[model samples]
Target: MGPGRIAGVVTVPELAEGDRLTVDGVDLRVRVSARRRRFALTIEPDATVTLHVPDGRPAPDAEEFVRAHRTWLVTKRAIRERTRPVNPAKRLVEGEVFRYLGRTYRLTVADDVPSAGRVRLVAGRLVMSRRAAADPARGREALVDWYSRVGYAWSVGRLQPWAARMSAAEPALEVRDLGGRWGTYEPGTGDRGVGLMCLGWPLFQLPMRLVDYVIAHELAHVRIPGHRGDFWRLLRRALPEYVACRAELDELGRRLWMGEIWWGG
Candidate 1:
């Protein structure tokens, strides 16, 4: 079968939603940005296509551009499908294991109300109390709530010293389930306007050493906005073995970062 039109072709630059297209039966999500100078396309980590075209470019040009890259798109899509993880059994069950600060613990769903729904890594099990031990959905939500609280508190403690060490201003810190790569650093605009630093909740699930690496990496951006030689130099000064930590983070990417949890906040 020939490529199909996945959605109505987008014409106006002001249109708020992304248009869709199909080539060789592969679905693509097309976005038109006037700020672009040339055609750029990427298959996101989740196996979705994002095509950015120069502003004011017409629909026909976009379709043709996609046709030219059809081969690459098809190949990448296949690779993602091949390596995609089948959904594992509910991870919140009684016996599933999870990691915190590089420590592994079995999950224990205890219905002890006096614990006030607080979850902890105790003895050898990550224990949380809830009325329903059999309902995976409730258990997952409870765990996410717990992760958010602990993640934010822990991140603040770590970010403080790094900020002082770098002589960087203490920007507002927010930690929630952003569900993406490690975290992000955004420099603020004016004096008295503190910049904002956000840490993804998933990073909290990994080891604390890796967590510090991400925090330091973001803090480095406060001094060097771009990831150029200067940025690397700054980061290296803070963490002497940051290169090795980066590679290790990549190795752990598939196991933790690619999960289908709620990408909240």
Candidate 2:
């Protein structure tokens, strides 16, 4: 229910939310969820390991689960190490390149005008006001905002067809920064009857096909809440080529610009 730190292997009556422990030299954060029917292990985007345990599960059970999956944990971590993001920082300078839907657009800093603080795509270039470009923080904000606005608009048109194929209702969608995740689906609640989908703004940089994969993946979650076999089977039925798209997304995603800025001397 709460956060606690666990060191080494020690038997405890129950595992609390956020409880941390090290097993086989690998650190894991415990997350006790009522929705979980059994133990599951997730390798997070940051390469941190999470042990998802059902509520009321004992600490020793968690340890045993991790030990059981030691091989998987090691292999996944190795894959992550090989595929870690090598995204480069961007400079808000003349002719700097940015991407949208797999197309490249050079940055063109414009003179400070009434609309100079905004970023826009004009004539195959990303134009920004000199005032915003001069400040890295402002420039980053403007670009991220542009991505969110454009991404939301693009995803709105794409949601329905995928939803129809998956037999899921098209839910309320938004685009924003989701840190380490590409997209997420939250089941609908009483006040909000339709489920909600959020796609990270950074995800807009990928090609349309990969974007569709992410959309289909999230839509599948509307029917199946977890990434279990059932979920994958459902997704595979809708998009037979999902495996290739997933691999491509993982590869290309590592190279996308993540709003990091470098002001060269």
Candidate 3:
């Protein structure tokens, strides 16, 4: 790796012939792609190396750029190695591991609800007591319902205070499906009232702080209508480290937030 490298792998798209660069302490493989529209760099997961170039650029120039970025490439490779992907399949089984509020919970299927329902404990696991005829789809719905009720009750209790602090008329809250977005707000309250998406199962897996962050964000929009600095200021006042919560919410959205249980007006 060289001295002036930002990522483990550096890409140079516009290189001419006779250009050469070297690395001092890193091993890298370079591949030149025939098609390149612009200069870009990508670090692979395992720290493997590849260099791409436009048709007009010379191969030598590309090699030099790769050599110049050797140091950065090495560091990025290390980061990618540490961050592993969470498996969604783990939640599909009974007595399996799952996460909620930054804590772990195991799945426990209880077929005897006494009133057709399901439940999960912070540590014990999911308790599913449904009919024998219930299939995976029904089981999932029953489980999701349990999550939705818990999320809704928690949001109203913990999040309403933030809205109350704004000293504005409390906007009428509505519940509905919002696909990827956890919740949303509209100016009018008739057909377009604030729509709160069902958090489903995955949302429970995140830290409570992240859930508070999302609720505050959507509730704030009911008053501000846009993502201006004031909106951010309001959010920060309610959640000092909202940025982290936002990142968590983004991760949750990408992996979870399936479109089901559309419950809006």
Candidate 4:
């Protein structure tokens, strides 16, 4: 309040270190990253609160920001948690439907569903060997493993061209549960000049065309790490309709994450 009293301060949100706090009985987790340029607060579907702070920001600033946005956080958590898919196979049941590679398949839970191989596709149905139809968690694990194996194969084919054209080394593909990220590209010169990419296994549930878009996106990151400037240019040249594919994937992803909502058997 010295030089310009009326228009005194200009601030941008950002984070420094990560820690947890409790405010008004709501638990908050704060994470700081130097790469982040602004402060962000979010509530995961599990109702966990997270505050992202940039490196240069003060800790007190983050605490105050969280306090100011408490109401919005609570509201958002309520909405997201209400729609979150239950833990493991909480939503899976007999005759439940799921999508894989863009095709709808019905879940058939049986004691002898057969876990020796991938989930059986018989007569357009996904036969789940729940081992007495009781351990839905194991069932989900088996299914995810199967999807990862398949995604590895499909992604290799989809990503090869980009690797070759860019004259860059092909990134090693890793299929796993990447939390909420669609895909991640870890640059080379860190792991012996070999790039590593971790793609969320759930993406295998979408159409190959959409999956191609994600592959292209990550491949684009091989040369450009951040989503700025040349990144868009490279992506546009690879996939002109990336925006539409992203929208479709987001919609399908929301339903797919539920793990049991498709209707076509």
| Candidate 2 local lDDT, 129-227, one digit each (tens) | 999999999999999999999999999999999999999999999999998789999888787789999999999999999999999999999999888
Best-performing candidate as measured by lDDT: 2
Candidates sorted on TM-score, descending: 2, 1, 4, 3
Off by over 4 Å in 4: 1-17, 20-94, 109-118, 122-124, 130-132, 165-168, 189-191, 258-265
What's model 3's lDDT at 116? 53
TM-score for each predicted model, relative to the true structure: 0.68, 0.90, 0.54, 0.67
Which candidate achieves the best TM-score against the true structure? 2
True lDDT of residue 43, candidate 4: 69
> Per-residue lDDT for 1-265 in model 3, tens only?
2333347865434443333334354433443334345434555423444444455664455556666776777677676456423333323445655555666666666555565555555345766654511455565666556666666666667656877875434455543444334565645545665543233345655778877776677777766655679999887887789898787665554444342322222
lDDT of 3 at 104: 67
Report per-prediction Cα RMSD to one decimal.
6.6, 3.8, 13.3, 8.1
lDDT of each: 0.69, 0.90, 0.55, 0.72
In model 1, what is the error at residue 191, expressed in angstroms? 7.4
Model 2: per-residue Cα lDDT at residue 257: 89
**Candidate 1 whole-model C-alpha lDDT, 0 to 1:** 0.69
- Deviation from native of the Cα of residue 132 in model 3, angstroms: 6.1
Off by over 4 Å in 2: 1-13
